[model samples]
Target: MPRFFSNKRLIILLVGVIILVALIGFSLRDRERVTLPEQLIKDAAGVGQEVFSKPAGFVSGMIGQADLLLDSYAENKRLKARLADYAAIRSEVAALRTENEELRKVIGKQESLRAYNPIQATVIGRNPDQWEDRLILDKGANAGIAENMAVMTADGLIGKVTLVTPLTATVELLTSAGTDYRVSALVQSGSGEIHGLIEGYDAERGELLLKRIPSEFDIQPGQQVISSGLGGIFPKGLVIGEITEVTTDEFALTKMAYVKPAAEFPMLDHVMIADRIAPEIEPVELRPESGEAAE
Candidate 1:
């Protein structure tokens, strides 16, 4: 026809009627495998599995809040290492209660030195140039402490053992000062026996005197003076003091009296050296005096 109406045959007859209406609309939407309604295909596959499980449930709730903040910072560092192990066991129980009260005052001074037969000693040193009446003991001569051993004091006589040393010793104090100290007293309840002497005049404020007595010895003034084993060095009754002054010298015939010792040699801490040796009793025989049995 005019060359099939020319313009290249009307563009190939409108591209073959748009490829026959796109092949009849792709054979009427051929992907129609539609046989739905199983509850609308399980509600469209649960809305596409709730959009891919809402990002895996928000990344599993942010990894469970980072494992509960790393288990609460490992239980706060295990309770600060158990509170520093309870403050180092309360300072070792206060240093074992001050070493058990110094071992109960050294077992109450060994039970008051077993009542006496004594020998135990210890007063290390003193006498840095005569410290108010000497002192220095630690027991000597294998504990038989010689050289005038008598030192006494559970509350009486204190001074003798002027120097020795197998282990150490030295004590000489009855107030020391050209010292002399003999005693053998009586008159607290009276039976008569007084004989006294003790001297010293100021070995740095430790003064003392207490001299001879015999002005018809009945010496009074709170009497009490003990220790009269007669120069066996001391041992007969122990105590030695309490008669504070009773002078008399209109032409001296003996009777001075001052005594006040009863152990206080600068508060002498610990003493006792007796070493036993007092036992000799014998005297009993009577009947004869009706004018001396008719002499």
Candidate 2:
């Protein structure tokens, strides 16, 4: 009888739980029929929108950053290319400037040569030996410059052409000590004729000795001397030098005179080539002072 009463209590507890569940369900159905609180519905919608748009905002920010990076990269590449182009242009400008300077010098030399009716040439090279006084020019047979041509500066004669190539030539200067040139000159003081041969004394110092001047001629210091044009090689009346010293001997027929060349050979930069000859002079006959009849 006690067991039956216990089972009856269990059944009553179950029935009570079932009735409570049914009443809760009926209450939820009635609540569904009524509208939700406006504030609560708005709050939920805002939360859902924020959650949905968060990813889109993040994606948009990423796209903007990527675009900025691409733009920056393109700008950097363009600047680098421009810099390279500018560098190339600068190099070209520098080269052009150098070429222009050289051209100007060449033009100046051409004008000077043209004024003197001389063959234009460029000094291409020089002798390596300090003792040897020689220079090579860029003009040669192709330019009408030949061997044995007289080379003179604006001041005076410098030398003669020794060797020539198609486009180049070599000059043998008067300062060369190994050379022997007997040149006839006129004395400025007494209008007397004198003869002298050049000899090299010192190669390094470019010192030349003039030997063989007639003693009867009154050669004085600072007297100008010029070529007599006896050999027909060099033109007449070209200035040679001035007499610096004169030593006369009582027993000797010839006097020794030291002449300083008019041209500074060491400083020779440009020279003229005169191929034209001077006009010939008429012969003069001497008459007797006592009015003697013509033979």
Candidate 3:
């Protein structure tokens, strides 16, 4: 080979240009085989990615676990509060049950004293001559009020419906001086209940006379008296009054107790008339049934 220049560097440069052209041609040619250097470089990059991804996945998993723990803590607090509230409600229910049981003992076997339907009425008139005996209400038969239905104030029983019209009804107070006026009453003595009749009123003392009590029974002052429900007119458990004095009849056959009325009859503005579920039935005459002759 002839030296192209008298320099060793020029000879090296001509050979380098030939090798560069050969490498460019080899790279551009269509080939499926990968070069060894390229394979090594790609494998190193893949290894680095795998090494870094493991730590990233571990960190992400730890973060997710921490979030779940925080959420569980919050939910536990809420559930504990609800449990406390449930305990409080249960205690209240137990107290109410105890109170109701005590009330049942005091009221006796009467399942409910308030079983009657109440009709609200306003006092529209009071007869001056019969101020302590009779008053008129604004509701009557058309309003489902009937004769002998018990009338009461917020405090206690006071009267009964004696007459009913379309738009008005007359109520006879317990303080009436009528000779025939009577009420079946029960005196709640320490011994037991003493059945009696409320036969008369003492206008002089402003008290009621609960008579016909058996002399054997011991009744004292300050004992309570209520309607006995033996009379078909009044419902059971109507509070009448408290006893103030006790005495025997003229014949000494029975006892009598003076009762201080619970209701203030003169201050009556609003009243409730009790319409009992059970009504008194009148006997019907069994006459000729459709042309049958009477005996």
lDDT of each: 0.61, 0.62, 0.78
Worst lDDT window (10 residues) for model 2? 278-287
Candidate 3 is scored at a TM of 0.58
Which regions of candidate 2 deviate over 4 angstroms?
1-117, 192-195, 199-207, 248-251, 278-295
Where does candidate 3 stray beyond 4 Å?
Answer: 1-114, 279-295
Model 2: residue 41 alpha-carbon error in angstroms: 99
Once model 1 is optimally superposed onto the true structure by TM-score, how far is the C-alpha of residue 223 displaced, in angstroms? 17
Clash pairs, candidate 1, are none
lDDT for 100 in candidate 1 is: 57
* Number of the top lDDT candidate: 3
lDDT string, candidate 1, 71-127, tens digits: 987878887888898788777777775675578687753322113377767554457
Q: How far in Å is the alpha carbon of 71 misplaced in model 3?
A: 57
lDDT of 3 at 235: 78
TM for every model, in the order presented, reads 0.25, 0.49, 0.58
Please write out the lDDT profile of model 2 over residues 81-182, one tens digit for every residue.
899789889999999978877997978633221122367565545676956678766566677876656677778767777666555567788777644444
Ranked by TM-score from best down, the candidates are 3, 2, 1
